[model samples]
Target chain A: MKIAFYIFSSLVFVALQTTIFRELTFIGVAPQICLVLVVVAGMLSGKEWGAICGAGMGLLYDIVSGRIVGLNAILFMYIGFFVGVLCKGFFKHKRIVVLFFTAAAELTYSILYYFFAFFIWGQMNIIYVFSKIIVPELLYTTVVAVPIYVLMEKINDYIERKTF
Target chain B: MRYIFEHKIAVLIISLTIVFLVFMASYTSDKARANLGKDGLSTMVLPFQIVFTSVTHNVQDFFAHFGDLEAAGKRIEELETQVAVLENNSRELEDTKLENERLSSLVGIKDSLKSNDSIAAQIIAKDVSNWYTVFTINKGSGDGIADKQAVITTKGLVGYVSEVGAKWAKVTTIINDGTAVGGLVVRTQDVAIVEGEFELQKDLLCKMTYISKGANIVTGDSIETSGLGGIYPKGILIGIIRDVKPETQTVSQNAIIEPAVNFEKVSEVLVLK
Candidate 1:
């Protein structure tokens, strides 16, 4: 049942990432719905499942972006592992943490992605991509994080309680 | 970690799936692009397009009503003032027109340089962000705007059609990073590659790269397409050179060029020579 929910959430995340969130972009910032979901899932689930979900989400993102394959997968896996470890230690179902996790995960993803793109992909102009792309995006995604986190918490709690 | 090592199989499966998808996507990209060609999507998108157009028009009308009323009042006042001004300026205009006609004749110009083979197109939508200065124009393949066709206004070059749908075409502007055009400094007669930089800015500008290092260039020098690439015509005005930054230990110089056309103020454009 949780697996089914995961698949459904995954599809919804991809669609929203491509269509709706894709439209909600500022100058250097764009909402990454997939990254948020992966982070939230990481917080909810343990490390292994979080990593798995992140890998799957990142794979989907790479497919959709149509530029630079495999980069997102690598980044998200690390993000999930790190964020999950952080959450596993001493975090409750707090809104601010969830928001922070989401923003941090996205920032980490962008940083790694661009770094790889520059070094591996041979892209010129090694500018500070994160400071521009991630910082503004962090604020935008943080503003959007509260409601999503609340909803995710409810869903996560419901799943844990009901499935058990 | 113990958890990750324990779920090695799941990790492997995830990694394999990604690799497989990437391989499939890379292998099928050309075929997919061919299959999902503009024509294929147009047929699918037509119905939705109509609905979107109608909804947008209705919403625009609804929102524009109050603004239109305010504008109408202002316009009436302006029109009255303009009428008096026009009446006063009529004699002056006639005199000016005579002088302009004489000067134009002396310049040895044909009365009509541009034939009626032009299409007027309105920008339907800009891309999600200004990251790519790509816009969808109302006219498309149906209206004879083919791929690689230049889009221009009375002012100068707007962009060229990169992709064409049935009723819409994506005009990738000169400011888009992926674009490059061979341009000439009209004043110096030196060729350079006009390419877009990553940084987006208010002034519609492009970076002119690969200029001959010793070429005489100055700010305010007119730049135009050299027609070396055969994509654009010989002398479509691109921009004025804002700054010339000569390459260090390289045989090229880069110049900042302010685009001749203001993309923001653009409403209609001509897709032609």
Candidate 2:
């Protein structure tokens, strides 16, 4: 049942990212709400579920994007699994930790993406890319990540309560 | 081996990672490697995207009316001035049309774009990642749209169709880093390659490279498709030169172009067949 819900939500998130959020740009960057969802899944469940959820969401995004497939799936799977494992201790359930991890994951994702997508293609303007693309998207994603995290927490809690 | 057996989650993660990496390698090597997954996923998501896009448009239009009231007087004055200029231009255009018909009859040149058919498609969704400037349209192979077809707005060239599915096609806009178009400066007739640069894409601009040092191109010089590239048809307006960067040691002189079609606001496009 949980897996089914994750699959359904993944579809909605992919749709939203490509449509509504695509139109709503902050500093010419959109908030990566899908990444936030992956983080939330890891925090709520465990490493296994987190990685599974991330892989699912990333595959959907890759298919929709029509780019090289499976790149996002692998990156997001690691991010989800590590976040779940690292936050297992005292950091678990803390909103501040979610913000920190979300920012870190976004930074890592942006850098790796730039390296693969642009840098390898001989666009080595890291400073310009960092200032213009990476930083703005990071800040925007970080700010929006909190609210999405909170919302996901509420939903997970509701699901737990209903299941029990 | 015992540890791997005990740690089922770890095994799963490692296995999935390997599978994904392998899949990525294969897909990269063969772009035409059956797109069944992509086609299936796109078909499922297309309806939702259409709904969301329409809702967003409606909301924007609703708010635009409020803003329109404040700008009404200014717009009317602007329109009045435009009407006067258009009337003058229309008279000149009529004479030019007569002259063009005579010249074309003498030369026996046929306009290819006018003879070809085109299909109108609405943008259903944009690229999920900020790194690429691609968009999905509602019409695809099912509607007679095919790969490498030129997409254009009434204003000017938007880009070309990069990938096509049954009912959807992805457009790689001229601002995307992967796109290159053959451009000709209308005034100087100097031909060059217009490419989408990473830095300029953020500002919705492209650059015309391979320009000779002696090229007489200037700011506001109009660019059109040279028809040298097999993809985009000839004589379609690409953009106007915003600025020119002088040649450096390793790089040739290039001019920054502001595309005629505002990518952000373009909702519908015609796919030239």
Candidate 3:
């Protein structure tokens, strides 16, 4: 049941990200809802679930919207794993913690993505990319992550109650 | 062995990452790699994208019409004055058209794009990544659209189809870092390569490079496709120069171009067959 739910939700999120959310840009950057989902899944469950959810979402996104295959898959998987492992002992329900982790994950993802996609391709303008793209996206994704986390928490609670 | 047993998830994650890294490496190195996964995924998602895109457009049009009502009177007044001006200009244009037709027959000049077949397609979605300026259109190989085909709007050049599936195609726009087109300056007749840069994409602009050092190119100069590359037909308007940067130590002089098509508002395009 959990697997089915995750797969269904991932499909919906990927659809939204590519179509509606693609138009909903704040300062030319869309909120990374899939990233938020991975972070929330990690925080709610554990490393294994987080990594699984991340890989699933990343693979869906890459197959659907990404130009290069498996790029987002690897980035998202590690983000999920690290967030899960690091936030293990913390009060996972805290909004501030979710926000912080989302921001950190977004930053890490953006930097790593930039390094692979642009930096090695001779686009050596980190300052400009940071100012123009990364920061705005980070703030936007972080702010958007809160509501997504809340919603996911509700779903997780419902699933847990049903399971046990 | 104890540490590995204790951190099984970490090891698993590392192994998966390495596997994906290999996939990425192979995918990049081989352009002709099997795209069964991509094609299957795209085909499945294309219907939902079309539905969502249509709904969004309808909603936008609804609000846009409501807004238009408030400005309708003012717009009518302005349009009335413009109509009168356009009427006079149309008469002059008719004479010019007749003269051009006569001169063209004498010169044996041929119209390029008008002679080719074209398919109209609606844009279903923009690229999900913030780094690239790509968009997916509803038409694809099934509709006679293919990779590297020129895409345009009534205004002018949009870009070219970079990838195609059965029912959808991805277009890499002129502002994307991956696109390059042969451009000719109409005023100076100077030919150069127009290319998209990562930084310039933020402003919906591109750069025309490889101009001769002594070439007299300036701001506001019109640029069109040069027909140097067979991909884009000759004489389609590409853009107008917005700024000219002088030659520097490591780079040649280049002019920034404001593309003829406004990508932000473009919803439908024609794919030249």
Candidate DockQ scores, in order: 0.18, 0.76, 0.68
| Candidate 2 per-residue lDDT over residues A71-148, each given as its tens digit | 899888998898899888845557888888899889998899888877897999999988888999899989988888
Poorly placed runs, candidate 3 (over 4 Å): B1-15, B29-34, B84-106, B248-252
Question: Can you tell me which runs of candidate 2 are displaced by over 4 Å?
Answer: A91-93, B1-5, B29-34, B84-88, B91-95, B248-252
Q: Highest TM-score among the candidates is held by which one?
A: 2
What does TM-score give for chain A of every model? 0.86, 0.95, 0.95
Recovered fraction of real interface contacts per model: 0.00, 0.74, 0.67
Q: For candidate 1, lDDT tens digit of each residue in B1-273? A: 897798785666566556745654564322222124334433333333334444555665698898899789989999999999999899899999889889988998544324336788876544432234666677867777777777888888787877666666767788876688889998889998998766643246789988887898999999988877756766788989898887797888888989998865565788873
DockQ of 1: 0.18
Q: Write the per-residue lDDT of candidate 3 for residues A1-164, one digit (tens) a residue.
A: 78877877787777677778777889888888889989988898888988989987888788776467789998898888889999977974577899999999999999999999789989999999999899999999999999998888899889989999
Clashes of each: 0, 0, 0
Ranking by lDDT: 2, 3, 1
Choose the strongest candidate by lDDT.
Answer: 2
Q: 2 or 3: which has the higher lDDT?
A: 2
User: CA shift at B67, candidate 3, in angstroms?
Assistant: 2.9
Ranking by DockQ: 2, 3, 1
